[model samples]
Target: MNRRFVSKVLCLASVSTLVIGTMTGCGSSESKATSIAQIKDELVASTGAMAAESVFSRGVYVNYAKDAENPDKTYFYVFNGDGTGSIEDGAADTSNYFEYKIGKKDVTFYIGSIDPIEEKFTVKSSEDGYVYGSFEDGLELVFEPVSDVEVDSFNATNYVNEQNGHDFVYHDANGWSVKYDPEVITVNAGGPMTTFVYTAESAGTNMITATYTVDKNAEESIKELGKALGDKAFYTEGIFPGTEDVKGYWVVLNPEEGTSGGYVTAMARDYMEGALIFEMDGHFGEDEENNMLVSDTLAGIVDSLTFETK
Candidate 1:
């Protein structure tokens, strides 16, 4: 199989806004926030401003609901104790650094040192703790606190290979390994299966899951699955690079041209335990133009994967 590689570089644009008259005092949950200026005025007149500082600066916050609506997009924002902060947009996979000013009721974000965007700070209590909610452009955006370790990984320097720009590195106990960028993909490892997810902007989400099987060699296991899937898909058998005599298989789904969602590839190879089976699936909406782009990105990751028999 031929492997295709993909790389990304992002550029940020500045946006500006103006603030009107300031309002003062803490409003109840029943009251709707109008503007950041009013919220700032209230902070100046009350003692709650101090509390707001602690709340905003205590931890990193992420747009929890963005991934559900647009799997390819998620963003994070955090307030530094010194009125400085940053926001990372997952869609573009870029970080925008900024200086921030906190008022009792809202925080103003200054991007590019010129554009001042004001957002109302209404802290809502959830079962998991407190989450900050803001109303912007008719959408009630909610941000929840994430762990410090996860936030640390969001930094570009924290990745596996800084010079090469690879963001994540994983090695299983069985001696298999893989490297990929966390900004464009994420992994969930547990039980007998590991899942990798990639969100393609405007196209859809791609998920690849691998399950380990003990006592079954790669060729035998794949053949069994291929027989069951028969004619429903196309299959190719081969050997992975750097491997000796061990065999592997690749299966691609066959569907109509206008199919909304389907499997892209299913493959497996011999490993320390027995075999590591992988199934790739794509979820595309009405827009499918980016399907090949998403597939190639995911394929690049799989190509980087290496397996060893302990």
Candidate 2:
């Protein structure tokens, strides 16, 4: 797994004071606090994350503050076991030059022209494989051991600024973007499914969606896809280019009378930890042929898609 994937989702700072991981005290009678190397050694040893059989798939999600609605004002950091990551400290416009390395509970920082400095962080809590702690300044930190299988995984890096300071544009960790205009679009995030709806605008009431899956096995995954469609769709084994590792199909339904495009779904992209699904559920305007309007639109999006995983 020599992949360099700094997740697009960033773990943002929030003010929910109800800390979540399991807790421990950093102070010991002999020294009150431990050294950086001692902390990392104890942490990795405690979690057994250094082992090969451990299921600590999801990386760490830490925040200095609480979660905020306005992201530009929020700051956070994302860490992975691959020895790679990033930090967003509310610095806008100016590029913040910094590099970091995380070893067990030990973290080293190399900022600007300054020499690399090492710091020891404590694991105040640990739960479900996640560790929660903070800096010497009591900057609340939580190391959420996540599974890529989980859809709404928290981390500020996961949410991309699709809106280039203009329209409320969006594209998810998954690879699809909506064709509908952002102004008229409404997003519903906290659902069993993440859905984007377009009301009577360009493309005539279009809807885009993304679904996450954790089925590492092929047979079980296909079975789940079948359950989702529930027997009304017509699917053709279609090739989603650049997705050679991800075998998939294009599914569509009979368009309604007077509607230009039909419901289109690009089912199953074998991704990083599991899989993803994309569906365009609306009339995609009139193209040369009938169904091509929807299928072609999906195809175009897929072609322009690129994943940032190493």
Candidate 3:
């Protein structure tokens, strides 16, 4: 992937943690400890109905903590029921953590700042049995399972040529078709993943835009292809945009003219089941309709994604 895209993704992931920390009341040592203990208790109580043997096999809940000086810096301690526990940090790793028995099965919990730019918390098991908690309201999380298909089985040609092949379409609230195009290419390697790309075209009077989706597992292959395309390929960066969904690193790139706007926004979610990526790029033009059309097009595609198990 492009270096710029990588940077953006990482930045978003980091911001997410900060947002989560604030949301969970990690602003002070006392509040942080209290919130962490309460959350752990909730998990234990929710899983207590299961058999003791099953419970022992499951992990124990440990108190979560935040940095003594920096309220936004949070960490979680997970016990293994046998008196062993592991510590997780918001700065280092934010993806997977210890699993606890919620019912008959063991479910993993993740923590990160994902809203208001600086809050953090643990997600609870929703109706689907998967944890779906978020401190920020605007951000969405999609988790899909990795398919059994081998990475070599993915055909880049077929992927680029599909009828709906990485297409982005925009519609107005009035039900009018504003603009539509399929201009981006996406390739996947193995697990659940997604990517984002932006492209635009100028019509006689308006500008048309398209945004592409790339899977997380597809990063390796995409990077390779990008290299083959020469120095124009994407690269990773240490900074990201926005406050919610902050991460340790991000991926970013400035697309060539006629391709898309100078800036592109991208993010990736690595889950036990699979992974998903979200991206957004705007089209620049004098016409307001063109800009609106491009924004709506990218937003629509992003809103349509759904997560499923393999």
Candidate 4:
């Protein structure tokens, strides 16, 4: 019932984080991590004093574990500067506190005689203060600075309590967030540029039929794209309102397949000095309702989006 209109603006996002001293690495099954001493050597050279404070000092960490008391569940915790830490056990809808320290890449709880109720890390420092330690089993883990922004998982179910309200909600790994109705759209599938793929109930809907990408080469790419699109795409600087400076505009796209009964449109948004880019396409039936849905609905969605860029 809805004709198709391609979303034009593709707002990209770019963001970029923490943890631990050590004991023996966690269970033998986990990843075998580089010793803490080695990590320190590599970290200190470029980072200098900032990284001198071991990841063990303070921060939040996320990890998974399975044992007698705790099944293989993921845990998120904040290790305070005072040596005390609080952990969240979502299964129980509860949280607990403990004392912790890293012997190397290993974290021990309570005291010397106590086995590490926590786990260990196979330490790898991608940047200065940024540390990624995979548990021996290779589950992904992150140590986030306490001051970093956070968001509920973008895929959180019941995204909108109202059945007819926006159905899909997303927070990119970096905490940028957005919501949309799933009955009409899909998300990013594979990736190089497009981080999300979306679809609607239009006959023109074809997998890979539409595209979206977050271009790290944003500025050059956008400038190149603007030149290519020529007069068809114009800039409306400061498109994002109430924030720094956000601007975007629409392009009346050409028809796809036969002009039987539909139209396509493309919208692109440039932000974070083009470091973060987002582009979306929409399809609408030949009806005004679908047309309105395509334009108004998407404009509102883009206006409400919130994210941080590095």
Candidate 5:
């Protein structure tokens, strides 16, 4: 696997405690504590009914801190009732899937195509409505249950600042638009997908491909694209500004030492009778710093995205 792609997928698994973004937490020494073992036992006895009723099996659970190196990043998880979920880093613009089957003493998380990580989790107390948990590896996470309304508030407050702070803006006739820094970015229009290129003077190139769909739902279409990219494909989802149903996913393949064949971010939204799908591909170079530069630049372009269904 390419290091760049790994970096994106593992952004949610970061080891940090800096309070950032819209979440906050406090230490709890007086709250009740339990282990995954106890929870698993209860779950098994209930024949999966408990899963449907458990708060951990629904909505978004966000970490209280952002990545120390990338403070703008927001890490979170969405655990579905079917033993499947996603690890997400919002500001970093990355997400991936994880499958888990509760064991006697731990929960095994299979994220993307990576080797499974077995977490011996000890659930601590909830402070200010934020749940606290510690893993065997000394990694502690403080999670707050976020509602859809809250998510919309967060997106509106955070991403609104990523507007056209660039030298140029591109508006497609297809009811979508993006802002890009003309210093290092160029646009190529006139195709099914509009291409934006960012070339590092000393390293490699990064690209974003934008398009839409009119026949299916956004989430299902993005998942299908991820599966078509192969089992190694990573998945991502999020709400974009001006839209509630816009979802995104991506995949990386043909990895080399410091670069890869392609790292794609596939996103879509259902509008009226059709859907709008947007995609971004980053082809980074051997220079780790330059790779990060490209990633940040492309992330900004994504942040500046705006669209209309009609």
Candidate 6:
């Protein structure tokens, strides 16, 4: 059987924003402990001419609503200044405009619409080291440090279309040839990396598997790389071509043990360009022909990998 080898690479991009606003009364002093009006005046004086602009700066953006037609909910937005913002909900969209002001230092803006005249547009600034926001029904919005910010890139390495001459087809040791095509290829982009998944089927067996690749140089440590693969098995054999020294891992997944199933093997390798990973999965029963077919297919594909180390 012809061993089909597939490689997938997931890239992630980092997005960061620096905020440079001073808290109203960060210094401990009896005179600094004043009313809200005094705090606002101090902030205005410090801003000078820019006080009139009232512009807010952030690295991300978010929006919230119960429904599109009648948005009764409110949401917070963080703008990254790159024309890209993160929405809290996967279903909500962002507005084209953002607002802020110098007088509202250490303050968060809340956006909501209550009525024609009493729209929920207000800013709650900090005073005496305390920040506060007004909310309906005694609801309060608190500010906290952003946690675990991550961005991902597109996965374009594992291209296995038959018309492109990259289809997986191989011959087995028993002289039985088997070939199959993947059902779908999906790319998930997040945090520091990306993931590509390919689903394929066998002709006679109900088994299916996927082949993938990754960049080893992108990760800071092997343990981190292993964590990124997330709940998958590892292996030392069946590595990509020119990546003999790289480590490998995999996970044996079987919903019904002792019936008919397969396992997933993943390998992490270092390429001159970056870290490269490959995954091969198989599912079969006690049929010797099917088992040998899958084994040979995996071996052939691993042997044919070529790394462009730079």
**Number of the predicted model whose lDDT against the real structure is largest:** 1
Model 5 TM-score, all chains together: 0.40
**What does candidate 2's lDDT look like per residue over 225-257, in tens digits?**
555766766666655545446566556565556
* Clashes within 3 Å, all models in order: 5, 25, 55, 56, 1, 35
Please give the distance, in angstroms, between residue 175's alpha carbon in candidate 6 and its true position after superposition: 33
The order of the candidates by lDDT, greatest first, is 1, 5, 2, 4, 3, 6
lDDT of 3 by residue, 1-310 (tens): 3344355446655655555567664366766566656655544444422322232232222222221232332333433454333444423322232333333433333323232122333333222222233234423332211223233232222222332344432222222122224553232212222233334453222221222234334354335434554665465633222223433133445546675344444544343333334444444565668666666665655445433221
TM-score of candidate 4 to 2 decimals: 0.39
Worst 10 residues of 4 by lDDT: 8-17
Better of 5 and 6 by lDDT: 5
Taking all chains together, the TM-score of candidate 3 against the true structure is: 0.23
Q: TM-scores, in order shown?
A: 0.45, 0.37, 0.23, 0.39, 0.40, 0.27
Q: Report lDDT (Cα) of residue 98, candidate 1.
A: 73
Task: List ranges where model 3 is wrong by over 4 Å.
Answer: 1-230, 233-250, 255-266, 279-289, 296-310
Root mean square deviation (Cα) for candidate 2: 17.9
Best by TM-score: 1
Q: After superposition, how far is residue 119 of candidate 6 from its true place, in Å?
A: 71
TM-score for predicted model 2 compared with the true structure: 0.37
CA lDDT of 164 in candidate 4? Answer: 29
lDDT, residue 192, candidate 1: 79
Q: Each model's RMSD to truth, in Å?
A: 19.5, 17.9, 23.2, 21.7, 22.4, 23.0
RMSD of 4: 21.7
For candidate 6, report its TM-score.
0.27
